[model samples]
Target: MPSRADPLWRHRPPALLWGLAALAVAVLLALNLGALGAVYRRAGPAAAVFGPADWAALRFTLLQATLSALISVALAIPVARALARRRFAGRRALVVLTGAPFILPTLVAVSGLLAVFGRGGLANQALGWAGLPTVSIYGLQGVLLAHVFFNLPLATRLILQGWSRVPAEHLRLAASLGFGRRAMWRHIEGPMLTRVVPGALAVVFLICLTSFAVALTLGGGPRATTLELAIYQAFLFDFDLGRAALLALVQAGLGIAALLALAGFTLPGMAMTGLDRDAPAAPGGMARLLDGIAIALVAAFLLLPLAMIVLRGAPHLAGLPASVWMATLQSLKVAALSVVLLAVFTAALALAAVWSRRAAPLLEGVGMSALVASPMVIGTGLFIMAFPFIAPARLALPVTALVNAAMALPFALRAVLPALHRAEADYARLSASLGLGVGAHLRLVLWPRLRRPAGFALGLGAALSMGDLGVIVLFAQTGGETLPMQLQRLMGAYRTQDAAGAALLLLVLSLAAFTLLERLIGGKEPRHAGT
Candidate 1:
C-alpha cells in the first residue's frame, strides 16, 4: 500500500487496450443480445407458445441433468478418495489420465461407448453366453451412460482438488486420538465433502443440461428429447421459427436457472491453510483392498470403451469414404480458425482486464457471457440475421468457429489473466528500469510467461472446435460437412464400420491438435546447470 510506483498504481490505460476490450464486448453483445433480438422478432404472437411436447422436453432436460450430476458425483467420491489416500506405482499417470475425458471429443467418446455396449457389442455377447437377457442402449439408459462416462472424470478431479487442500495435520490428530473411519469421516472428510460436492454437482448439471450431441445420438425419440433437440426439431425439421425462438428462450431460462442455483455453493477454488507434510495413513488391510478395487474398477470403466474403439476401428480405417475425408479437412480448418480467434479475443480481454481497472469487471463478464447462452440460441440468431443478406450455409464454418471461440473465451481468459498478472508482478520494475518499449516487453518478458497458459487454452479451443456437432448440425449442407456431422451421417446411414473408423480418426485428430499446439507454442523451458 505504501509503494508509489506499484504496477497496480498505474491508472491510465492505453487507448488501444480500451479499443480491444470494447471490441471484445461488442462481439459478445452481438452474439448474445443480437441473437436474442432476432429470436424475439421472429417469435410470432401466440404461435411461439410452449406446448406439451416442449414441456416434456423441459422435464426430461432437468431430470437427466440432475440424475447425471448425482450419479457422477456419487461414483467420483470413492475414486477421488482412493486417489487421495493411496500411493501406488503409476498413480501420477492415473491422475493425469483423468483429464482426458474433459478435452476428448464428445462424439468420439460416444462412439467408443457404443462400440462396447451396442446391440452386437462385447457386453451383449457376454450376456448371451451367460444365458441372460441383453440390454438395450437406445433410450434414457444410453444417455445416462454417456453422461456418466464424460462427467465422472470431471467430478473426480474437482473432488480430488478438495482432498489436496485438506490439512495433513488434521489426519495426524485424528490418528493420535485413534479415531475410527466413521469418526474420521464425521469430523474431517465429511465436512470437506459438504463444501466440494455442491459445486461439482452444479457444474456437471449445467454441462449435462446443455448437452446436444449426446442426446441427439443416444436419446432423440419423442419420450427422450431434450430442450436442445426440441429446438433443433422446431427450427430445422418443422421450419417453425416461432417455436424455435420460443424454445431458445426456454433454453436460456434453464441455463439462467442453473446458474442461479450454482451461486449458493462454495466453489472448489477456495483455499484452506494446510501443513506442508504427507497425510497420515489409516491402517487396515481391508481399507487398502477397497481402495485398490475402487481404482481398478474406475480405470477399467474409463479405458475399456476407448480400447474397444481402437480394436473395432483399426481395420476399417483404410476403407473410409471420400466424404469423410472432406469432412475431416473441414474440421481441421474450423479448429485452426477457432484457435486463432480464441487467442486474439482472449489476449485482448486479458490484457484489458489487467491494465485497466475500470473496465475489468465488465470485460470479465463479457468473456464469460457464453455460459448463459446456448450454442443453438446463438446459431439461431445468427441464422436469422444472415438469412436476409447471406446464405446460412456459406457462413457455416466461420460462424461455428466464432461461436466456438466465444464459448471457449472464458476458459482461455481464466488461464491467461493470472499468467499476465504474474508476469507484470515479476517484471514490471525491471522492464521499466531497462526502458523497454511495449513490444519489447511483450516479446522478452510477457511472452515466455503467457506462452504455457495461452497454448493450453488454444489447444483446448482447437479440440472443442474439432469435435463440435452442435451448430454445424444446424448449418451444414450436404457437401459442407465437418467431421462430427459426417460421423453422425455415417451412423444414420447404418454404416457402423465407417462410423467407427471416422470416430477413431476424429479422436486422433482431437488429441493430436491439443498436444501439438500445446507443445509447439508452449515450448519447453531449458534447465540450468549447477542446480
Candidate 2:
C-alpha cells in the first residue's frame, strides 16, 4: 500500500514520523516496566505468587471473563443476523445506539445499570407488584450482567459488520441452491461466525480479564475482585509496588499469550469477510418469533440503563443552576481539546501503521498500558513519580488529554489506518505529481480519500475523551471537571439528583457529538467483503 507521494512513496520525506513518535511515547511510558526489576524487596520469593487470596482473585477473574465472553458472543449472533437482514425503520438508529456504551463512562454506566437491575431497580419494583423476590445486583453475576449490558451491542456491531459483508455472489449462490433458513446459515452465516467469533471473544475477554471499573462498582466482595482491582488494592490499600509490579507482570503475560494465540488466525483478508452483505429471505412465524425474542433481549440489555439515566435525570432538569451550566461548558472545552489531542495522536498511530512492520505490536502494547494500571493506578503512580519535581494536577487537562488519546489509539488505528493504506495504494502517483504539503494534502487529498475513516477515528477519540476517567480522576482536583469527573463527584457526594441531571446532559452531548463527527468524517466504506 505504499505510494509515490506518501512517505512510503519513495518520492518523499519519511512517512515514518508517526512510527518515530509512537516509539518515543512507548519508550517514555515503558519506564514503568523498570519498577518490576527493583528487587521485589518483600515479595518473599518468586514462587509466592500462589497466595490463596491472589489465586482466588485470578481464578474468579478468569471465570468471570470466560463466562462473560461466551454469553456476549452467543447472544450477539442472532442479534447480528437480524440487524444485517432486516431493514425496518429505526434499524439504523438501533445500530448506532449499539455504539452508545463506547461513549458512556464505565462509572456512569455502572450507575445506570444499578438503576435498572439493582435491588431497588425497575424490574424489582414491577415484579414486587407480582410478589416476586428482589434480585441482588452485586457479585459475579452482577459483573457479567453489566458486561453483557456494555459489550453485547459492540459485539453485535463487530459481527454485524461481518454479517453484512457476505458477498452478493454468495447470495446468488444461496438462491440458486434453493437455500432455506437452515441452509443459508450453514453456507453463509457459519462462515461469518467463524470469522467474527474469535476477535469478538478475545476483545471481550481482554476487557473482562482486566476489568476494574465493573468489578470495583459491582463486584460485591473480595472473592470477586479482578486482577485490575487487585492491582488497585495492592497499590492504594497496601502501598506495595513490589506486589503491584508482580501482578502487572502476571496480567501482561496472560494477556500477551492470549493475544498471540489469536493473532495466528486473523488476517486482513479474513477481517473483511462477513461484511460481504446480502438481502436475506423473509421468515415465517417461527423465525419472526425468534427474531422478536432476540431483538428484545438484546435491546433490553442495551437500552434499560440509558432509559434509567433519562428517567433519573429528568426530574432535576427544572432546578439546575448557573454553576452547572458553567461545568457543562468546561466539559465541552475538555471534549473539544480531548478530540484534538486524540486526532493528532491517532493520526500518528495510523501513520505509524502504514510505515512499519513493527507498528502493530508497539501500538498494541501501548494501547493496553491503560489496562495494566488503570486510572487510579496510573494517575496515582504518575502523581507519586512527579511529586518531587512537578505538580501532576497542574498539568491535569494536558495529562487527561494525553492519557485519553493514548487509550483511544487502538480504536483510531483500526478506523483510519486501513483506509489510509488503501488510499495510498490507489492514488500515490497522482498525489506525488501534485506536490502537496502535509496540511494541504490533508485538506484536499487525504481528507476526501479518508473522510469516513477520519470521522470514525475522530468520533471515537472525542467520545472516549468525553467519557474519560483515567487522568481526570487524579488531575482535576482543580476547580474544573470533565463530564465524567463531574458525574463521579456528584455520585461521591450523593447528590444523585444533580448527577442524574448531569449524566443525562452528558449522555446526549457525547453521543450526539460522536455521531456528528462520524457522519462528517465518514466516507464510503466497502459495501461487501469481496468488494
Candidate 3:
C-alpha cells in the first residue's frame, strides 16, 4: 500500500542498523550483567544478613525518594498551571532557564544551597535578625530541599507540556460555554493531570533512588544514609564486598521497581516548544496576581542559590590552588571522552530503533537499561573485576567517562530518534533513488538533519560528566581527581574560599561546555532532552 506520496524504498529493517543494535546491546549486557555477576560471586553469607543500619538505610532511601517526588510534583502543579495560563515579557527565557538545574552539577548546587540555607547563610542571617530560630540545611530536610530544587522545574516542564497539548479549540469551546474554573478543571485539566502527573512522579522518583552525590553531601550521618551511600560506606570503611554487593543488589532492585512503575506511560521528552503562548481563556484580576506571585517565587527559588555561588566564587577565582586547576584539566578530558562515547552509542542505538520496527522496543530498552543499575553498583563491579588485572585508580578517568556515557545514553537516544525518523521519512527514498551509499547519505542528509539534536545530546553529556562526583570518589587516588572531587576535597578540608571558587569554576565550565558544544554544532537554537 505504498501511496504516491510515500517513498519507494523497500520496507525492511536495514542490516547495518541491526548489526549496530546487536553490538550496542552486547556491550550494555556485558557491562551491567558482568558487573552484577562479579558482585554476586564476591558476596558471602554476610550478604543475606540485613542489620539494623541496613534496614534504616533502606527506609531512609524510600522515604526521601517518595517525599521528593510528591513535593516536587505538588509544587510544580501550580507553577506549571501559572506558566501555561499567563504570558509576560521574558516568559520564554524563564521557561528555558527552568532546564538549568538538569545540567547543574550536583555538588555545586549543594554548595549554593549551603550558601543560602546553611547556619551562617542568608536564611539563618535573616532569621537571626528577626529573632527566629535558624534552620539546618543538613539531614533529611536538606536532602528534600536539594531534590525539590532539582526536580520541581522538571516536573513543572512536564506538566506544562500537558497543558500545551490541550487544544486551543477546546479552550475556546469552554469559554463560549461559560465553563467556570472548577468546571474547567473537572472537564479538561483534571484528565490531563491524571495522564501526565504519574509519569513525572515516576521519573523523578527513579532519579532520586540512585542519588549518591546529594546524599553524600547532605546526609548528616548513618541516620540519613541512602542505599547508595550505604554501599559506599560498606565498601570503603568495612572493605566488605559481601555487604557492598548486597546493598548494590538492593539499590538495583529499588531502581527496577521504579522503572516498572514507569511502564505503560509514555516517557516525556524535555523539548521546550509550544509552551510560550498565552492561554486562550486566561483569567484576570486575582488569578493574574496569583500567577505573578507563583512565577516570582519559583524564579527566586531557582536563581538565588546560583547567584550566591557566583558572588561567593568570584572573589576567590584568582586564588585557587594548582590542584584545582589540574582537576579542571582532568574533568575536561573526561567530559570530552564521555561526549565522544555518547555520540557513538546514542547514534547506533537510535538508528537501529528507527530503521528496525521489529526490534525498536528491544533497542530502546537496552539504551535505557542503565537506569536499572546505579552508578555505584556499576563502579563497584568494575572495581572488583579489574582488581585482579590492574589498579582501579589508574583506570579512573576512562571508567568515569564510560560510566557517564552509559548513564547519558537514554537521554541522548530520546533526542536523536525523532530526528532520525524524520530524516528517514522525508529523504530515505530519495537517497536510495540516488544510489548513494551509507557514507554519502549520512554526510549529505543525516548529518545535517541530526546535527542539532546530536550536539545538544553531546553537550548535555559533557556538562553532566564535567560535574560528576560519583564513581570518581571510589576510584580516585592521590592525584586522580576531577573538578567535583577537588571541590569535595576543598569543602572537606574546610577551605571555604577555595571551595566556593572551585564550585564557581565548575559551574562556569559546565555551562560553557553545554553552550559551546550545543551552539557550535546545533546552531542557533537547541532543544533539550530529559533523563
Off by over 4 Å in 2: 1-50, 267-280, 321-330, 357-376, 429-443, 478-481, 520-531
Per-residue CA lDDT of candidate 2, range 1-531, in tens? 655544433333254665555554664364344334431443445533547778888889889989998998899889987776666788877777766885677777888888988788887888898998888889998999988877887788888878666776677778877888889878777767777788888878776777777897799999889877887788768866666666767776777666775676654444433344454465658877788788877777788788889888889877765566766676677778868866766666565545455555675456545434344445555656566788766777766666666666667766777787777667655666678655565577767877787788788778767776655655666477676777777787888888888878778777877888888668445475543
Q: Model 3, residue 476: what's the lDDT?
A: 80
Model 3 Cα lDDT, one tens digit per residue, 432-474: 7777666677899899899998888999999999999888988
* Highest TM-score against the true fold, candidate: 3
Q: Where is model 3 poorest over a 10-residue stretch in terms of lDDT?
A: 269-278
Which candidate leads in lDDT? 3
Worst 10 residues of 2 by lDDT: 34-43
Clashing pairs in 3: none
Angstrom error at residue 340, model 2: 2.3
lDDT of 1 at 184: 77
TM-score of each: 0.91, 0.86, 0.91
User: Which has the higher lDDT value, candidate number 1 or candidate number 3?
Assistant: 3
lDDT of 2: 0.71
What lDDT does the true structure give each of the candidates? 0.84, 0.71, 0.86
Candidate 1 Cα misplacement greater than 4 A, ranges: 1-3, 8-10, 45-47, 167-179, 267-271, 281-284, 355-358, 417-450, 523-531
Q: lDDT score of model 3?
A: 0.86
